[model samples]
Target: MRSTIVRIMRIAGLAAVVGAAVVAAQQAPPALVSEQELLDGLKADGSRWLTFGGDYANQRHSPLTSITPANVNRLVPQWTFQTGTLGNFETTPLLRDNVLYVTGPQNVAWAIDARTGRQIWRYRRELPPNLTACCGLVNRGFGVLGDKLFMTTLDAHLLALDMKTGAIAWDVTLEDYTRGYASTLAPLVVKGKVIVGVAGGEFGIRGFLDAYDAQTGKRAWRFHTIPGPGEPGHNTWSGDSWERGGAGLWVTGAYDPELNLLYYGTGNPGPDYHSDSREGDNLYSCSLVAIDADTGKIRWHYQFTPHDVHDWDATEVPVLADLAINGQPRKVVMFANRNGFYYTLDRTNGKLILAKPFVVTTWARQIDSDGRPHLEPNQMPDEKGEITCPDITGGTNFWPPTYDPSSHLFFVNAREVCAMFYAWKPEYKEGERFTGGAAQRVTGSNQKAIGALRAIDPVTGERRWQFEYLSPSTAGLLSTASGLIFSGDADGNLLALDSRSGTLLWRYQMGATMHGTSPITYMLDGRQHVLVPAGTTLTAWAIPAP
Candidate 1:
């Protein structure tokens, strides 16, 4: 009788503990709002825009239709605030209440009044002079939540600032910038957690996405792109290739709150030209991985380029949308991979719904039924040399693309070009840092048609329309419900195109190439205005009151 009572008491105690755990999990703070609700909120009121791409769908689409195509001709410069910096002005200004938060070179952040454009406060992050940057010194944007403005520094530090007064709340180092890891992308906030990805895939850093507690700077979790020994996908890499594998998650990702999944694109495997050292399909690299936001577990993945030989890193932002496919409404995640192929997958299950070439691609003959690319064996880089179309860059799209839900068309700026590639055995020396690969490059004869803005149908992978430019495009794009598409060019032209058809509606030259940032639209004092940070100045345009 005593033994039975003890056993029953222990079992009851265990059940109570399990019950408490279940209740605690349920009582935890509510998960972030669904992606659709976030998008709807942005479209409803143009106030309190807290994210880099305005609510994570990253459509860059605004529902405010006050500035239409008809009156866009009357647009005039409202105000321009100069940051007095020298690098590219790729900052996307975030509007909250009536204050605007922006970021620039060296991770300098400014809080200004949205209506008057007067400086409220400024947070300057002190960075090392010897910082290594693969590209120019540029930060895409910052994130706002409650009373904090979060951003990443050039030296790979994530800093949070007080929204009202520019004071540092928390400063945490993201990576060792000395080891070639730096962060330029904005910190994405989801469910009270700040999510960030590391850049420098070319500099030979293993890629991963990290989540940090919003209130405290403690790390919540990390998801490594390259698997290690005893890991589930370790077999994908061969002979210690996992040590230096390059799968950097440089860009921001999209989240689906309905399914509780975060979709992020991974970059290429390292050693750029020489893939002989790392054989087999490098799992997770050059793919779109769907991860659980709370637990950081990879739910599913779709690889765009397995064992990518070229330097085509799949670092572009994945856009989410609901579209009619085969007479059924399917939730889809669309991305134009750097390898020159546009892919659409079922956002819920990682099923490849469609895949098509968006640019001048010659390496792969076609994307097979199982969503794998059928390479033309000769197109792979050789020990001697091989001429590859769509070079290290890719077709027309490199930066973030915009989607118009009204027209169901995806707008992308692309490059029509190719390159000559030669892979050689890398010479490694002990105790000296090296990328472990050798390469020689030659420009192709048909390296022209460098820039073209194309409108594509993500459903069919068809080009609805295209706008060609004299120079290759490096800037990003934005769209609005007012039937306007905004993008910049390498020639320094900030242009507005008709959303339905790719027609040039308006253009303004800012005197320098627009690189790596998208335009934004907002309402100030009951008047809609378009804003683009060019070079070092934030320029705002509005229809002059007549």
Candidate 2:
């Protein structure tokens, strides 16, 4: 009888504890995300990483200095999280309050415990078998605001998922997949609206940037990259060329809150090499368009390639920076373009400040004072192939570069190579690739393609320093105030370098090259952890506790 009484008292005590926990949870207010928090970027507090570029400025510079060059070798792996999927990661993972929100290939997403590397919830999509997403069936990342997360799908849809649970709150179709539309961009959430762009320039689709109401999933506005009838630059394309003029804005762009403008770099025009199919300067394709954030209207645009026959998509990342030039502070946008050019433009109004070649560019001699490319004769693609410097991939591709505002330096992995390009008339089908040309890599014993990590002054468009690799690297970059810059080579090596001198400080073979992936840093358990997503695994490294 005494044993029974003791058991009843023990059960009652357990129930009371459980009930108290429930009451406490209900009374505590949920942590709400604020706009200022996003603007703060990667702070020394090391709490969260909410955006793709780490900030609206698209500066991937972190202020953490706990792990310096002197003790970087002492850092060891804390934990590893694997996707267990087939494809490698091209997406950047986001972190909040000890939980990681990540998007993977084929629209697989997860919210995982940052400390234990265990998944809290996972979201997998039922993708269409006949999906026409060009390049790859991959997602970039997620944008979170106020207990909700946003992601763009391979089937051209934007989905809002609950933060705590991976359940879909709402899904809105951006465009029909059958119409050759796909969205791989990480949605940019600004001013209570989610901003995104479609990727299908090679498939002969007209690309546009769309804004959706974050709460209701209702589309707020759409700004077509190509001008329609009666638009200012409509005549730039002859006849119906503008109908399928392929001005895709595939990559994520930078936002300037003070200017209320969102700047995005556009993709190559369709019939990619057939010059006659689209005549005159394809106004907006292969350009950077600054649009009003509130209303989807183009403020001004600067065309990188006036009438490009090469497949060099201006889809390379655009980084925004404020620089002082000749004793005057100027708001500028920096771009390391794929067409072998490094450009610095006045962001407020699209005006060319400086344009210089970072690689061997054979098609254009130079940019004229009036911002026109002086084309070289006999360089256009035809039935017989023509060799071009910097190849079809240009100097770089969509892999993001980094900027150090303190150093006034922009860092990019540039390719030094050439390719033989061939063109034929392409008959456009509903969901078929519409690129009229293809490029063959020019290679031999003596001829080789190589890559280098280049640091250029944003003000002068001149090389500050460079670190060469055996081959071109598609990896992205990260920098810190600790005088360190993290990068990866094509040979499966994660590298750390001095930010000012470009001297190698440390190296680790991650088994796979970063391959369009970047290393993100944060604080965990009182230690700073560097997280790298290479291949299918996320490896977290930290210094051993003293």
Candidate 3:
């Protein structure tokens, strides 16, 4: 019969090409978890606790083990709320279902009710009576999606509320808050878009990283980190420093959705002590790029201080795990860098598998085996003064660090201190607002005091343990598989430690000073808590037997 009807049309075209290759390998992208399946999927249910650091590999590690360390000294406090508006509260709250979103000092925003903290809706944000806060009126939190609620405005706008009636659905403005650019980190929604970035790399302003359109606030794509004519790193940058060349993608970026990329992390290159006016090797700022969240492109970049004159702004937050180096299973990313080293990379391309020097570093005398950092021609800062040694706040890490994956340990918060740079000679001015370069501190030097809480080994950077903070930690760190770690202390206490041996165990004190946001754990009804907001309040703790 015509060769059996051509063998049933080639067996129905081979079963439709094996069902479209099994739906493209089941949509690919998502296989990066494994810090013990992200602390057993944050203790398997903690109930809500949505975004910002929590569900983002930012690893503010939660897993709500119901508060351990042998009863966590019976933690108390239960509720506080405050926010009357102050300087360094540093926010970082965002539970869903029971509500709770936060954000204070000027960019204000509330929405409470995470189990009776009250205040159901606030949203202030008038700001701009002069606005030029280099380090204080913090915001660092906000971004919901689904019913809306995204923030970012120290004057750079970005709005979007209405997560059930907070109202204001769309705002947009992203920059030019008089040119000094603002938006204190925290607005990263990926997939549906919304990912923001911009924080005045010390005020020279020129970095970028927008995305918008979580349902039409517009903007779509706009990478930039300093590159202009013909792009592709624009020959690294020399004269106009690619027009102020800072890089400042400010913070918040670590999405993989199975390689859809979006890693981010770039800062420092600005006038921060004048790297001459922006000389070469400035491709993508302090570097860690990766992009392509739909098409912002990039896909690869590592930089980590290439012509950086030390204002160390790799702005932290990179995490993204899956260890097991030599025996295989890689996919890293880790980062402690603020120019004090401790990297890992190769999160699917950016390479540089490791780089040590966790601290006390005298401005790179090493870090090259591909992790490149060799600087040290007197550590730059010419014009007479140079004394760097984990100065400009480095060595002890910054902006939080935590990755426990069943104690593979990373913890962080190291600060041993050292600085005295001096790179003056800029004083520029074309239309006013310039702060590109200027440094001066060199005196009797040394001024030690160290400040510990180490515990690294993110695939062999070493330092497996230590805990000694009484003063230098600028705050931000959290961990939990129940053994605990949560940090904070420029003297305001709020400790915990003992994540398998750096000891300490419990503390509290919070009268004020816990700067950089980091501390969150949850599990509402079944019990467990830990919150920790500091300054303008939010407290929470728990465990009086749950």
Candidate 4:
């Protein structure tokens, strides 16, 4: 009788302890994505991807070496998540705590379980019938902080969504979409602010950069690309042409925490090809601007094409790195511009270190000491027509490139083609096409449209090696510390190549081109997984579990 009574008392005590533990767990707050995590970027533990470029420097280089060139060929698709949407994907997916946050075309978003490729919640917006998203009906990606995920809409609004429930926390209008203002780039979150920009350069809209408080939807500051009445660059434009100068910011930029500055590439001026109306260098358009993150003050600017008339936006992505020049260490920003020139500039003061043509460019022979292009005569477009190499797409558009620090290589997909450009005086209409020129592909016995993945040395601005694609590939790139690169081609071949030699190591057909999208890698279930978004599908690949 004594033994039975002791056993019953012990069981009751254990039950009480178990119940208390459950209560405590239920009361605990959800894990917050701390500011430090954002700054840490892609950590070695492979826990999270908190930013678009995988880090503030826009390196897009992962340090995870779990899957290298040797085992890369063994990568098999674990599961595929379909978006079930019509348009192609251009957004980079953000991962945190085994969950994937994806933004699809048409302002659609999803929160998915990374382990199972299953959707937890979906959010869709009812947009206006007339969306003046000049480029495409797409979004770049989301920016996260605390418990909120931020995304830009096709109608020019920025939304803060609840990460767990996919519900709206706050909504803020960026600009009037009906008046030729739209946004498509990923929002860059830094310090305590979310930085973003407007898109619609071809529609005669003046562009600007903005920062908003992460907690509230209130804007912190706005930096106009085109200067106002008394500002210094206001005289660059002719007459009231400054109102619709069209230096849109459509691509994301790099940030320097040490300098507290943000670097962004601006777009082309309006009446794109006819230069009669807007004259005299056209101020900040076709240039890169460095701005103070807190105050939105312009620190320095470098114009790639002064008074650009060939429709080269200079809206390429800006990558920051600390490289050695001559014999001394220096900070630099490398850009492969749409004007068919590759440049390495001093990031600290926006001075040109080296500039060289990467393709068959007939517009300019070389860059002068003052960082101005030495123009080749008879290159400007007119009503009759003028033939130019690199065509209208310039060299490469908005596809994100990759920089491998170990190899010191800058990789990009370049087009080898030219076109006959035609120009006319375009009538301006609000929210309508305002470009005064169009490009016709030049196809002849000697002409061809070929693409190649070229590796250029940042120190010398010279070609190190190149891997040619059958056609011009629009895919972005991702590099790993294990000497592997992930890219897709125009023929829908997802590929893995040796970063050092550009040798093909592995390939898979994903049934769609990775147009304007790049793959991201992370650790899941003790193995590194490469997640790719192409067309309407999101496929996760990794080496088979042991």
Candidate 5:
């Protein structure tokens, strides 16, 4: 009887321990994000979105196909999340493990439940009063690795927040905001480094892209967009122009794991339209730079516009892909540039493979065989103002584009607009607008500034098909394997088009335009959800269960 009682007590103790462990497991946090998962890009399972461009290639294309062109119309709103802040979202929210990590305007961020579109934790930064952020007070997005989320502020600082609690892990200053430096792009996480760049091109701030240690906020290296005195591209900038040359990197870029290279597009030169003050090719600015990921060295660069005078920054998104061109396999970086040209460049060496106009380009007829543009007469802006096609926004701006590998097509929201550019010699002051010129949209009877969502054959630069928007759209794009391309109109309509034919598959009025943001899709609870950020609200859409 004594032995039986002892055995029963031991069994009871074991059961109690087992019960405690089960409860602990239930309360444990989700698995921390791994680098392999980020390298996986958009998986077939549609589990998570780990990066800014949905993958390092910056494809913005997904592999999920649950909602195809046929049933995309049936997508219904599951839930809506409002920022309840002053500014709209200019960010591409990151998703992992059914939780959304989103950044908003005014340095506000949140961690929300992916299944319910409910807020889990929110972060708001107390910005300085004397901010000289050139554009809107917007943050592009967040980058995550392990349990920390990295973000850049309008006050020119990079912060790593704890992924679980929205608490700041560490913060590092990128530059001083009072001196016209601000960081707006989403931090791109590669390997174990968090890569980011600064803005304030209009405020005469020299721009540089920096990589930081992911665990600590310590900066690893910085590559100045404007080359220094003894740098190889130094001669490209005559006189002291390279100091505030304004090669701002306000958009996220692509990464190639095999090459270990980060490809980023640089912004315009300072004194934007008056190139005479700072002459020469202005190396790096208005260019696409390929940098060694481990080292802050430029492997090679291709300037889309040499000595750019029209305020056209080459800050458009770069999409990397491997394609067969001229009957040969080619590794290429495709760019729909703000200079009204679409280029396919050999990614390995920064050589131009092909260049063609995707819009009404009057600045230069075409890029010559030597990779220089054939300049048109009287295209330069002057005191009297000169008219140029593509206007100041070029053919497109910073809105993210998408590429569908299966379709062999590149998609972008393009604008057909022209502007009268006026330039003058302006005095430079610290922490002030340094653009020596301005542009006015041409509203002549013959010039109608309409917009279109165009699908282009990257190999031939030929238009496959296009859907016209009443006005130029500032929305980014998203494409899926199901032959659906998601876009937004300036008139506040969310649209899904047939990727193969540009047919209108579905449409919904979101009441506010997407502006500089794009919709992201992922799987939640066995259902595919499309998250749309228009104005200040994030609305999740999914088809009702049958």
Candidate 6:
């Protein structure tokens, strides 16, 4: 009887071990992210948000309709995750496999559980003491592929981290941070290559965009925003001016798969606001360039605000779409420029289809037929100062705008403010602020600064409707298929607006403002969730389970 009992016990132990192994295998993730998955963009199931702009088109529009305008007011906070760091979030978080990969200020990142808002892994970089990050010590977000996440550092380096464990897979330096070069843009992954741009436009550093091998961290090609000696646009800048021209690209751009081109808007020239400092149009600066993704060659470019002196950097996001203009199907790129112009251009050859003022543009009344601005008299700034309508921040800044393809409406948070701009000759000093100008906000009884969330008809350059704010808001925007637009006021109020009519539907005081980040939505556990990053905390909201 004892021998028989021992035999049965051994068999039971073996069966238990085998059953545990089977369960583990079943629970494993499907596989690392595939190329086709990235190309698929946002799906109907709402399973992931794999790219920065939700897709290559840079349209922050989601297809999920569970959280409709009628039901969005019913959302309740599921969980809140705090950064516990110094600065605020300027990132667009990426979601995959029920996990959120987010990058925050001061080079800190986290992988959190989508279900519970729990941190699964955290990654932080030890930055140097004298870092010269001009804008803020912030990281936009990560670019993911296979098993790794790619991020640009404030110390001018690019790193690939293991998505599962947040371990550094590879690290490569883009430039010396001490020379006033820093990178804060999110990496954009396209076809086995990671593309990123350096930021130091205000510090007298020449700008360039780089492509690196995603697997090995090897640089594939470099495209200088400022043309070189033999380059085509080299003559656009005066002698030796192109060496330190500031066409830095700190904002993420859109990509077209069929054209195999990357569209990026460059920054203002160095010594900003002083026209004589760079005597020419400053080729590629304050312009949009269509670049060959495979060869890093410039295919075409359209300069908006050529030789801009109002500190207008064309770093605003470029959105792509296919529109039927005048009964002709046209593939076009739309841009609301900081120089106070809204433009529609042929994405194929960079030809202007239509250009009009979306705000109070005093510098120019309109864009001429040949795509040049019809400049107004005495608008340029000098030592005595000149009052410009859109101010130095322009009508809209670097914060993103959204596009709804179904409704054919483009939305942006616009500021209506004027500024007195003053400019003088500046001396060049490496690793120091190089702007030779200043802007003072115009304020008085009739000139109060105000903001509005405006829905624009891109085809006609007309305002469909606008929801006004008490103060000028710097927050980005997001839209959904269920007819909801998410935005934040300067006063820490998160708003849900009806996308069609711009009617206020719901408002919640988030306790902090979403500075330059837009809220993202996805479906989790059969409930649609809106993930918002405001101040230093990330909060997830969803409707109650039925």
lDDT of 4 by residue, 1-546 (tens): 001111101111222221122122222233688778888887544867888899988889999999999989988887777777668899999998888889888877777778877666677777899987776799889999999899888788898987777768899999999988988889999888989999988889999999999999899999999998999899999998889889999888889988888999999999788878888899799999999999999999999989988788877888888998999998999999888899999999998999998887898989999899999988889999999888888788789889998888999888888989988998889899889988888998898998988899998989988899998998999999999989999989999999999999999988899999999999988999999999878888888788
Poorest stretch of ten by lDDT in candidate 6: 1-10
lDDT of 1 by residue, 1-546 (tens): 001111101111122221122222222232233334443547667754667777678777788888888877667776667676557667678876666778887676676666656665566666788777676777878866666778887888888876666667898998888777788887788877888888776666777899998889899999999988988788999998877777877688888777878899888887767888889888889899999999888889898999888878788889999999989999999898878888889999999988888887889968999989988867767666787767676764337888889899888888877776766655433212334433343454645556788898988999998888887787888888889888888778888888888899888777666677777788877888777777777777788666
Q: What is the alpha-carbon lDDT of model 6 when measured against the actual structure?
A: 0.87
Full-model lDDT for every candidate = 0.76, 0.85, 0.72, 0.86, 0.88, 0.87
- TM-score to true structure, per model: 0.89, 0.94, 0.33, 0.94, 0.94, 0.94
- Screening candidate 3 with a backbone cut-off below 3 angstroms (N, C-alpha, C), the clashing residue pairs are 29-257, 29-258, 30-258, 35-405, 271-436, 391-418, 396-414, 396-415
Minimal lDDT window, size 10, model 2 = 1-10
lDDT of 2 at 29: 32
TM-score of 6: 0.94
So what's the TM-score on candidate 1? 0.89
Cα error of candidate 3 at position 204, Å: 11
Give the per-residue lDDT of model 6 (tens digit) for 421-444. Answer: 999988888888888888999999
Which residue pairs clash in candidate 5?
A: none
Per-residue CA lDDT of candidate 3, range 1-546, in tens? 001111101111222221122222222222222333322335455765556677666776776676788878767776666666556567677775556678766676666666656555566666768776466667888876676768888888788876554557789898776667787778878667788888776667788888888777999898888878887888888777577666776568777677778787888776777676666887888888988888787878898878877677787888888888899998788888877788888788888888888777877767777667777667777667677777775664337688888877787787877777777656544323454444543335447466777888888889977887755777788887777888877878888877988788778787876677777877777777777787777767666541
Report the Cα lDDT for residue 418, model 3.
72
lDDT by residue for model 2 (1-546), tens:
001111101111122221122122222232766777776778635867889988888888888889888877666666777777768888888988888788888888877677767656667777899998888778889998887889999899999987776678899999988888999989888988899999999888998999999899999999999899999899899989888888887789999999999999999898798868888998799999999999999999999998888888799888998889889999999999999999999999999999999988888868898988878887887899998887988899888899987888999999999998889999988888999989989999866898999999988888999999999999999988887889899989888899899998888877888888888888878888888888877777777799
What RMSD value applies to candidate 4?
Answer: 9.5
Off by over 4 Å in 5: 1-28
What TM-score would candidate 2 get against the native?
0.94
- The clash numbers for all candidates, in the given order, read 5, 0, 8, 0, 0, 0
Off by over 4 Å in 2: 1-30
**Which scores better on lDDT, 4 or 5?**
5
Q: Which pairs of residues have clashing backbones in candidate 1? A: 395-415, 396-413, 396-414, 396-415, 397-414
